[model samples]
Target chain A: MKKPIIITAALCLTGVILMGVLSGKDVEPGIVAKLKAKYSVKHAPSADHAGFEALKKKFTSPRQVTEACISCHNKRHKEVMRSSHWNWEREEYVEGRGVVYLGKKNAINNFCVSTPGNEGSCAKCHIGYGLDARGKGYTDQNNVDCLICHDNSETYAKAPDKAGAPEAALDLNAIAQSVGRPKRTNCGVCHFFGGGGNNVKHGDLEKALFEPDRDLDVHMASSGSNLQCVDCHTTKEHNISGKIYSLASMNQERSSCEQCHTAAPHGDSVLNEHTLKVACQTCHIPSYAKANATKMSWDWSTAGKLKDGKPYIEEDSMGNHAYMSIKGSFVWQKNVKPDYVWFNGTASHYLRGDKIEDTEKPLVLNPLHGSYADEDSKIIPVKIHTGNQPYDPVNKILIQPKLFSEKKGEGAYWKDFNWEAASRAGMKAAGLPFSGKVGFIKTAMYWPLNHMVAPKEASVKCGECHARSGGRLAGLNDFYMPGRDYSAAVEFVGKWLLLLSLFGVLAHGAGRILSARKHRNGENK
Target chain B: MKNIKEVLIYSGFERFWHWAQAGLILFLAFTGFEIHGAYSFLGFGDAVRYHNIAAYLLIVLIAFAIFWHLTTGEWRQYIPTTKNIAAQLEYYVFGIFRNAPHPTKKTALCKLNPLQKLTYFSLKVFLLPATLASGLLYMFYRYPEGGTTGSLTIETLRTTAVIHTACAFALAAFLITHLYLITTGKTVTANLKAMLTGFEDLEGTECEPEAEK
Candidate 1:
């Protein structure tokens, strides 16, 4: 009794000690301190600097404001002219296809089609003044719209089709006077509203980032790290790092978690080993569109359906647009789990004049290229935005349809509600042939999910990827995972061995018991 | 009744704890296999829910059993001994069919044979703890703050799952052998009746005092 009591007390004490050790405070603040030291720049020239005082003069056009600003910061416009954001064109060598010129300029995407004829609506996100390269030459010094990014007043609003000029009554002098470092609100003005509305293009980026709490994004959390967009996407001479796979040019520096944290950030060595095959975003960003619903799928075939001879709009259960007569039927989802894919940072786009070989499968407008065999490839999360768009039946190529118009009778699909006229005009403007035979073809575009990182405590659980069925990585047979992947032959042999052993034990025990019983009975007799 | 004697082999608390643990183990196995997608009688979600509840109940039962064993000094019964273990093995293998006598005698102070002591001790000390620890880790993998447990990657989670499953298989094997051994008592119903009534039929002679030591 005394021994048992002592042993029980020892066991309880051991458990208490183990708990205390495991709950000890962390000692490594080295990485966070290093990141803060390296990139934290002085809040870009405060408003009282002489550069802002010179901007107190009257300004009419955005170009006039740029000319005055360049008088003091002369090299700013030259730096802006070299970026892809200024030219709207990118050239890169894809694996199967030789060197190809691809960008929003000529590449056909599922959303908003090509930018050739739709530059007025698309160029609203462009940093420079004018629509595409038509209004101002690439070398034009006055075309650099500095206030678009530097405006702290947040009142500078650019109207579509006005040659990158703000609204009629807006105070350009106030915007010029308040120019300073850009904030999350500054970059989000155009990026968050991409693809015609909020949470449309990149499911991970939206208006919620403006004042996000820690749950939505730990880095951009108002009460946490509170990092700005440019913190990780560092810039040199107006050239920003971390271009998307669809827009990246050759020899560009890609932004990664290694910029702030070491490659092996986890304390556990086994977990650190997975960094080679898994992207940080795959685990960090558990889901996208946490703050709002994003468009998942669109069926353009359902568009142009009018109610009582007028365009109509219908809302789904979540109050997201289910159908719009001008656009199409859309399926919206919130807190969406991302699809996993292998990416090697290189992407191939289906540019205009590219042939459609397989009409049976949805046309891949922009396909990220990678495989498990590639050392450069890692399992990354992506959001697949699927839709149907107009294509030429006889020409066997996708046709861009003009969707928006400043006025009626301009062959815009929304105004005329005619696919044929819109296709002909859009194709003519894009310098592509139209066969007068139009049909809707299924198409898909992949958008990489790299934002809306949840706090580290909400990462995916073990069974989510390791279970035999209904696991996240169930069908990914390229790489071997222990619990998830097993050999049937090995299992069969193991089962047989267990069965044989059990049989031997049963037979031997039965023989011993029976013979003993017989001998005892004989002795008694 | 017929030159037979009955002795108190298992206490009432011991019998109750044994049966409760056995029932809980069976339920856990059923639900665990369903969650593993072996047969899927219950849907994945429902199987997970049932498995978690059964696991919690088993944990509570184990805690109570440990307390009872410590306070009553019954924990000493499972301390392993090599004495007569070879003889016990020989009896199972060859001597039993010849009507040879049992190598070791049972008493209230020494309730388990040498082989039972070792197997039960290992199950209690190693296999059961492994299963429970891995299971709890998997249950609370994600923290309330936002991410998973500190430094726990998906690979760590996968490794934990493998450990839990391997321990479960070991437990199943042990249970099967235990069930078969129960029928090998002096009479087929002797062991079952003892577990149910706390009294077991034994040979006419009293147990040796040295056997308890």
Candidate 2:
């Protein structure tokens, strides 16, 4: 009795001691500590430098501000002139083909089709000035619109018809006086409002980033790190480091998390090992369009609808525009989970003159090139924007229809609602021969999502990738994952072993019990 | 008249460890299967929590059991020997029904037969340790993101899970056989009563307690 009491006391004492020790263990500092330490020290450039005080007042046009900026900066305009933003053309070496000129000016996108015959409205986002009706602005150094990027004042507004120039009555002197490092507002003016509306072109970028909550974007959170555009996209001599998805290249120095964070940012080496094959955004961002819904699909066949002699507009359950006679039918989605793809940071575009191989399938306007065999490739999250656009069936090439009018006499599709006239005017301006046979074809554009990183704790859980079904990587069979992958032979053998063991145990136990009962009966006799 | 006598076979601590370990293993197996998506009795989140708690409790029970075995000299009961091994097998398979006597005599110091000695030895030295180590590795695989704590660098938990589950099946097999064999003793309730009372009934007066080896 005494020994039993002692044993019970000992066991209880050990349990209590172990529990106390486990409960007293201290937790380690998390990733936020590392981020806070890294970005805490920064040197912000002074906005009010004495050099800008001597500039001439009463500027009548944006050109005057550019001339003043070049007077002191000297080589600023020359550098801007050499950039693709100034020329609106990028010389790219396509696989199997020689060097091809591709950019917003030459590339035919499904959204707004092309920029050739609609320069006045399309060039509203252009960094240069006076991009004529023919889409030519490369000749003048004074065309560098400095105030568009450098203006700290929020009042600087550009007129769409003025060809990237500020409004006529706007105070250019006050805009020039408030020149400073570019803010999110300045960059968002074009990027956020791309494709004719907010959150249309890029699902990851939106106006909400100006003062985003932590849940929307951890880096640009107003209550947290509050990183600016230029922080990761480090620039030198006015040349930005990052490139759009249409112009990505492995050889170029692209903006990546590795700019500030190391390759192995996580403390767990297991997760760090994933960095070599999986992109940081694949797990961190999880989803895109957190604050606002973005355009998912567009069907141009539904266009030309008119109600009461005017363009009809339809709204979805969320009050988002579902259909517009001017733009056709659209599907909008919010908190959209991006599709995964292996990207090598290099993209190839189908130029305006390129022949369509398969018109029956959706033409990949800009295809991201990578494969599982590529060592440089990583599984990246991308928003696939699908739409239908006009193409010349006889010429076997895509057509860029003039969507907006430069003047009253111009044959714009929006003004006249005539496809043939618009196609004729657009092809003539682009210096391309059109057979006048027009048809709408399906097209897809890939846009990489790299923003709206959730808090580290909210990253993808283990089961999201390891489960057998409904996992994020369920469709990604390029590589094998543990719990998600299985072998029939191994499973079969395991089941057999378990069943055999149970059978053996049952048979042996029955034999022993029967023998013992027989012996008891014999003893009784 | 048949002579009957009672001898203490299990100490209070030994009985306590045996029952506690059994309860913990059952709980661990139940929770572990739920986590493996074998069933949906407990949700995944709750299954993981319960599995972890049961694993820790099992570890604690094993620790106390090991200490007791070492201190009380009960570890010698599992040192397997080939002596009378064939006789024990033969008796279980055929002779017992013919009113044959047990090939090996039970004593306070040598409570287990040769077969029990081998099975218990393997369970303690191999399967139990394999399950415990694999479970611990899976549990501590992740670390605080910014901390310098060491963690397993494996990309997937498939290998660890396989090893843990295989050991669990082996243990379940052992428990089934053990429960059945307990009924093959002198009476159906005799073995269970001994575990509860720390005393076993023998039909002969010739039995004597063996000296420590």
Candidate 3:
């Protein structure tokens, strides 16, 4: 009885001590509540975060990022103001389907929103702060204010770190030594769009940026590299043309690869320059075969095949399906075989002196671009009859013409004999290089050629080009050669590799079945 | 064996041109891919630098290769033909599968299979030439004797870009096939050995004592 009483007393004492230590009397929650109420965040925040929120406070000056420019270059400001950039604000709120207006005063941005006091990161691209704090109806027209670019007015103020930049003329505190132009980052921020969703138009935003592993975005944001957005994205009227495709474009097909490769394994005049611009993937990708691939495969066991791994082919659709300009669901790169193909054939150079006689049928010699083999070439037309689209009789093109050539003969030429040349020629004349959109993808948009088979769910758009079942059945395993047998070579190659290692193990096992010497020598086949 | 004047497969300048060209191409491919983020090999910056260096070097090498091939009459070697190609093809497809005799026998005088001859011909004359010309067009989009942007048509440039990309893919596929084919030599290492030592260990009894290198 005495022990129990003593234990209870001890426990009570321990609890009292614990409660004293755990009490919130020292935390000052009241002050925290006030802070939470005011800033809607935790207390003791970094000054920067507080400053960012302070942007909502009423500002007396309209001359921060916008007004500063009006003092000198009012014309440019008015022009920019008329543009779509100012109409984009992120302050749009959607609560239980509140009256959603889609334009002018409340236009929902097609992509990103740029608003103040909103955590919308997109605002950084086109936002302009007047005094940080915005009042009741502070038209963000003040956003994307003029001083950001040509700071003739001192309204735009870059940070101290950017001191080297010339001060805006509108800035009342202008410094004399300012001459910073819009750098690539200022443009790419929205172009790469935080590096996803939408990249810079017409070109890859960070084409070849360095140190991809580390957080180089900071450097991208602030490095102020001498590189300008215009360096690669040469100016166009409304729409800028990439240097390669435009008349002003300068890259020479031959020189371009060599510029980086440092050598010409295939030699000059190796590729045809006429009827096309020289870009590598144009020939490499062939066409998009993803949707049309009959037997999508992960295992290379069947390098190219139908679902059952059978060397079969679908019969062409019967509805008098004329070869329309946009032949639906046709694959590219027909006449595929396992062992021998055009790549194994001869080699030749075509230019002023070493010219090839133009032919109708494409030669099916080994066509691996001369990476292997020790043979000179003979000219033969490479034949092809695969791709989602066929020649357009009206315009004589593989695809419908937009702004340029209008003759039906202006596109991919097809007689159902040879396609590679036709495809190359047509693509050269019609297909948009990297533009893979359906109508825009002048090149074939089938599969297993340019790209792998799209995921099962993604390949449902065959009707976009192909005729229901007929197109599927006709080209099922059209890839299989008519009369070539590659099974032996395949088995031979793999078995030979395996045989090398098995030799030793087999030697020991052979001793039990027969003489080791017999197994080693065997009957000379 | 009838004595053939050790006719140069490549000139001194040509060999230098060839190796330099090959080296730069490999380097460019490696670096360019890294830049594409296909697979990080060298760090991004290093890859870009390496790619740029190789690209410039390739330009130099290509110029030399063009000059060498032009001067040496070696360019004639790429003349394409369809002669006996049908038979040679049969051997690669059906006959090869049956272990039948190869229709196109290899000799110093006739070193390539019919199919090989045709392929090399097309690559040199068509595919690769197209690729090179387009590549140059891409590089010079920035600076040239009198370069300007917006000069090339988007249609033209886009087509060229695709062609270039396609050529790269073809080259990659060829590389893969070549790697596999290297193992198909008489003794697996036979072809590689020939390339390295400039001699091959003849297989079977067809080895005329005089043919032994």
lDDT of 2 at A377: 84
What is the lDDT of every predicted structure here?
0.75, 0.76, 0.34
Residue-level lDDT for A243 in candidate 3: 21
List of clashing residue pairs for candidate 2? none
- Per-residue lDDT tens digits of candidate 3, residues A1-525? 124333544553354335434431322345435433543322332233222322333334434424444444455555554443444321222223332322222221111111222212223344343322132223544454443443322334433212112223333323111213344444443444321222211122332232121122211222322223443344332123232110111212212222322222122121222102222322322223211212111111111233343333343343221222222222222112111122212122110111113223322111223221213211111222222222232233232212112233422221222233333343332232312222211221111121111221232221211222232212322122111112344334544554553553344334333542444456543
As a whole number from 0 to 100, the lDDT of residue A214 in candidate 1 is 94
For model 1, residues A341-425, the per-residue Cα lDDT tens digits are 8888887778798889988789887788777777677888889999898899888999988776787788888888999999988
Candidate closer to the true structure by lDDT (higher is better), 1 or 3: 1
DockQ of each: 0.07, 0.15, 0.01
Candidate 2 chain A worst ten-residue window by lDDT: A20-29
Regions of model 1 farther than 4 Å from truth: A1-29, A33-53, A132-137, A249-252, A503-525, B1-95, B100-213
- TM match of model 1 to true structure: 0.72
Comparison by TM-score, 1 against 3, better one:
1
**Winner of 2 and 3 under DockQ:** 2
- Candidate numbers, best lDDT first, in rank order: 2, 1, 3
- Which model is ahead, 1 or 2, in terms of DockQ? 2
Q: Which rank order by TM-score, best down to worst?
A: 2, 1, 3
